[model samples]
Target: MPHVTATKAMPVPASKAWEFVSNWGGTDKWIPGVGPVVVEGSGIGSLRSADLAPETGFPGRISERLETFDLHKMSFSYCVVGDNPIPITNYLARMSVKAISKDSCEVTWESTWDTELDEAELVVAFNGLYNLALDNVEQLMLSENQ
Candidate 1:
């Protein structure tokens, strides 16, 4: 599993940041390549969906798909459903939040991707996506603060 983790100091309150990222569908707003995460059920076995990278113009988005969704846990673990757009064979994204202080919070986005891509190639791609999401969250929180 190719993995990447990113952390940023959000301007919004820890609870505020947790509310946004804890929702599965909200990922697209912060994570660059993420589409709207679709959820059907409620937990462990809940169904979810998204467009893979090929469906979009970006290469990384190809692995996006509806897998399992868990709202109560504030995290999502999914696999490639089928007919994804990218070269990824197996992929899983798990996002979590941790409070550091009254107004400070940390959101950790971790993903494992198995693709035809070489380790070096996937590393660069994963890093870019992770950083983009971190920057997006930072921007969103900052705007909310003001």
Candidate 2:
């Protein structure tokens, strides 16, 4: 199994960040080139699907299932379900936010998956995606506060 973790600092409180992150269906707001997400249920066990925007270079849809959610803890875990464009299987990932100060927080995304393909390449791709999404989150949150 290959594991990858990406973390970024945000100029917002953990609670503020969690408020945005907890909206599982609102991922498109912070994922650079993802279209609106369609959710099939509410809370844990629900499924969300979205198509990557053409400009993203990954022109395909992805479905993910919410595995665990904790509002108070500011954390959640999800797994890729159904068909995946990435050549990986058993993809499970978690996202969490931790307070760094009264006005700042750190966001971390980590995942482990099995793949027969080039692990290094996939790791780099996943890390890039995570960092990009986190960067988007920071920008959106900062703009919202300003």
Candidate 3:
């Protein structure tokens, strides 16, 4: 299994961070590489399809299902289902926000997947993707507060 984890300090309350990240369907608004996302249903078991931006060099859409949603914990887990553009399978990703202060929180995103590529290669790719997404989240959240 190849895994990648990235974290960033978000200048927002944990609840606010959770409210945005946990909305599975709202990913396109913050994830820089994702195009419009279409989601079906709500809450646990909902499915989300994310289309990758052509500029990212990875074309195609990936569908994932919400596995666990814990608002009180400010965390969620989603597993990739089908139409994955990445060269990996059995992908399970988790995202969470932990409060650092009354109006500050740390967000962490991690994932584990089985890939045909070597572990090092897969890790490098996923790391870049996760870091970019986390940076986007931080920037988007901060700008919204200004």
lDDT by residue (tens digit), candidate 3, 1-146? 87799998978898888887887788988776788899999889999998887777678898999999888888999999976888888999999999999999999999999977788977887888888888887787788889
lDDT scores in order: 0.65, 0.90, 0.87
Residue-wise lDDT of candidate 2 within 24-69, one digit each (tens)? 8999998877888999998899999999877766678989999999
Clashing pairs in 2: none
Residue 72 deviation, candidate 1, in Å? 8.5
**Candidate order by decreasing TM-score:** 2, 3, 1
- For residue 16, model 3's alpha carbon misses the true position, in angstroms, by 1.5
- Residue 8, model 1: Cα distance from true site in angstroms: 2.0
TM-score of 3: 0.93
Residue by residue across 53-125, what tens digits does model 1's lDDT show?
Answer: 4433454323334354445454555565556665666677766666677777777777777877587787777
Clashing pairs in 1: 48-66, 49-66, 52-61, 52-62, 53-61, 53-62, 54-62, 62-86
Misplaced by over 4 Å in model 2 are: 54-57
Find the number of clashing residue pairs for candidate 1.
Answer: 8
Off by over 4 Å in 3: none
Among these predictions, the greatest lDDT belongs to: 2
